[model samples]
Target: MTELGFTLKVFRQIGMMKPILPHKMLGAGLQLVKWGPGFPSGVNAAAKRFPRQLAIIDDAGELTWSEFAAQINQLTQALKDRGIEAGDSVALLCRNHRYMLIAMIAIMQAGGRVLLLNTMASRSQLGELAKRENASLVIVDQEFLEVAGDVDQDKVILAWADDDAPAGLPSVAAISADQPTKGHSKPARNGQVVIFTSGTTGLPKGARREEPADLKPLVSFFGAIPYRGNATIVLAAPLFHSWGLINFGFGLSLAPTYVLRRRFEPTRVIKDIEEQKADALVVVPLMMQRMVDADPEVIKKADVSSLKITASSGSALAGELANHYMDTFTDSVYNFYGATETGWVTIASPTDLREAPGTAGVPPFRTTVRILDAEGKEVPRGETGVIHVGNDMPFGGYTDGNTKAFSDGLMSTGDLGHFDENGRLFVSGRDDDMIISGGENVFPRELEDALIDHPDVADVVVTGIDDDKFGQVLAAYVVVKDGKSLTEDDIKTYAKEHVARFAVPGKTMFLDELPRNPTGKVMKRELPEFE
Candidate 1:
């Protein structure tokens, strides 16, 4: 039987068959009855239907669906034997690997919460997170074992490198051999996963699931996407981020083949795509830029025709870069717009990129978006204001009692944008970054985009500086192209020709590079102040 057919059969046996709902009911009316067989049913169906199909590929090895499911069962039994129970939080710290995927499934399947840890995070950060979440168990790869320093070794489960198990640790391979199938397959309560969000304040806030109902719409929406049977998906982003989790869940729900990379390496990424024949990749803006900037000979040598979809998120994709990607691949390059608190709000297709250039496209199936003024009233279509979203998306309020993020049932994204006449979203800049110069609002993104068009400028960040006459003055930090020399007058001249006089940056500072987060988002907070 086909994978879809097998899934439907299992759903029927588990009495999970239900009518699919339209995307319009996503926020207000969608509900998921406990009629379906749940997560295990979908996984088991994939195993039965495509037992030999490759499910996961990493540096260690590739695991077929059957092997993957069997490993999950074994891990679940092992954890259970170790005194773990349902609803316990399992803190996981590891790079992208086959073991991590199996452990995540095993934990959730056993009715435990999976608390993802950022691999790049400091030891203090991880320890604080573990303590804050009250994790019952911790798992770490040998590389990250140092981060767990003095954190109760007894509570940690380390994956053995060789066949020999570490002292007090169960043999992962041996456990799989003992019982290929051992745990009950039941879906946990909705909102079982607690993802922590970075707070504006010092402490990070943990966002828990609201209701099982919220997941139904997402699950259904994912099913409708063009995921092929047992297709390989390249996972390059950090698993701790929301986009990373979304990609992981997408693969899990569809039971697709996945290729895991420990951390993004430009050369390795090119090699893996060709070697694994990966069909899809989920990347951020910086990763894509690096790949594009890699050696042309290496890019030409790599076989990228097998790739069908390239999805980007976490930061904005410049229109020039987007156009170049489409021209190079001749395939769909999707730009997803949303936040950690909110799931996908809108998706910009390659077609949209070609037509509208910078638009974030229409809202996702059931999402409602409104551009609101400071008073929370809707603004005109062409007027820019704060962007508010209302949907079935689940968000845990801030840990520091900052409920002000949400206003009138809509989540405040802290972003400034406006909807075109056709309802396309144009995210101009962050509200905090808006420069109030001489009583006029100047969005840096407009000026930044104009500056980027200059031949000498490789990258540029525009910000507001204190001014005596004006409330705030505009400043530009620019990274010039290698082997190219540019002066402040040249930059100013170029900006004046390309952008409005008020929008032109008043002061320009040349910099070797700008600070960026792991996800490729510019760290505006880290920018140095200039006189």
Candidate 2:
């Protein structure tokens, strides 16, 4: 699509948005750019529009938009008074709560770059990250203070603590106690928001984000999902992740009440959905699976009928998992496929899921997905190749100065995929994960998907191991459902019946559960090596 077409599409989507009144659309947009096209602007605008509306609901308590904005102002003044100025970087290590958001907004308003840290990382990793990122200050939660490393106590600010501020170290409370009315000025440049990669493949890398040149990512999202004005959402996904970050920004315009929890629990989420009458659920695939795996009696009693959308990203939505979620919730599921580097590429609605169980779906308006051969030529539809994507939002680069492979003006997503006859994109597996058994190429997803659908198979992960006879052989690690027993032969026989013989596992091992990261992506590197 041309620039004019994209602008038109954005205008059309804006008109269709429930929360944005047509008369106020231009003013709302101007407000987003008042500070910058990033976070603080949307929040500032929302506060002006709905000052008394419920802005945040967390385990600790509730906060109105007026209160959140006032806190943002006071904290921004405090940070500026504390000598934090333009180009200074602050590392934020806090969970989902009102304080975390307040600190983040104030940091941006104070002209400090934000490096979002992974909550699950070890202390050693956190120390390394802060030093490597050259952070001037570390705003950590009381629980994570030990992980702040050798940073001076004066440079450490506490957040989300129930007790009084620790001696010497400043809490957000103490810092903003004077409630200075200064520091409302925007910086010369919008400080970049840096989020670390999931590090499933290797040590985590920081990916620096560029403020998108256009609003297409937001417009395209609303075009795909039905988000209402003043709705309630349980944001269960971690805010540090790219998926959660993007969704949170997109929602500020709608003035939705965000119901957040520091930790995710299926029972607790179901309870929140009932008590708050939430309209949307933001999660990753693992959280969705947990919802499906909850006790049936608990689900029966909960009043979750208000949930209209279950948006998932940050990992693949397995065919079996999608089916089970739609079956249990009656078609509220939507899967968003994209990379932390590249913004969202495609979205699978309930209709798409019902039509093609495991599809990544087609690209939204003004986006492109193409399959390319090893030689960089576009392959015919239905032929497997590396997936390349182009969209309004392009990845800037890694903070380490490295970048992803680019082909024909699109960034390589590093996954192998092909388009179906119906034009739905199906991601097979990581291109590097393909197995060559006796010269026959196979994708482990095919076998994994087949096993996941089995009645007694709770979960499965398949990988290739070197073999003397076959160049490489498939190894299957499974989690068996409770009260069921199965042998290696039984799994192999089922694999043979469902998939090609060469795809069958050479051995099968059962684990009580699979190792996963906070976002619910399986940790393939942590799977025990099979002999």
Q: How many clashing residue pairs are found in candidate 1?
A: 2
| Separate clash counts for every candidate | 2, 0
What lDDT score belongs to each candidate, Candidate 1 first? Answer: 0.70, 0.83
Best by lDDT: 2
Clashing pairs in 2: none
Can you tell me which runs of candidate 1 are displaced by over 4 Å? 1-42, 159-180, 185-191, 198-201, 209-216, 219-225, 398-404
Off by over 4 Å in 2: 1-30, 164-166, 181-183, 200-203
RMSD of 2: 2.6
**Candidate 1: C-alpha lDDT:** 0.70
- Among all windows of ten consecutive residues in candidate 2, which has the lowest summed lDDT? 11-20
Per-residue lDDT tens digits for candidate 2, residues 312-347, read 998888657987987887578888999888787778
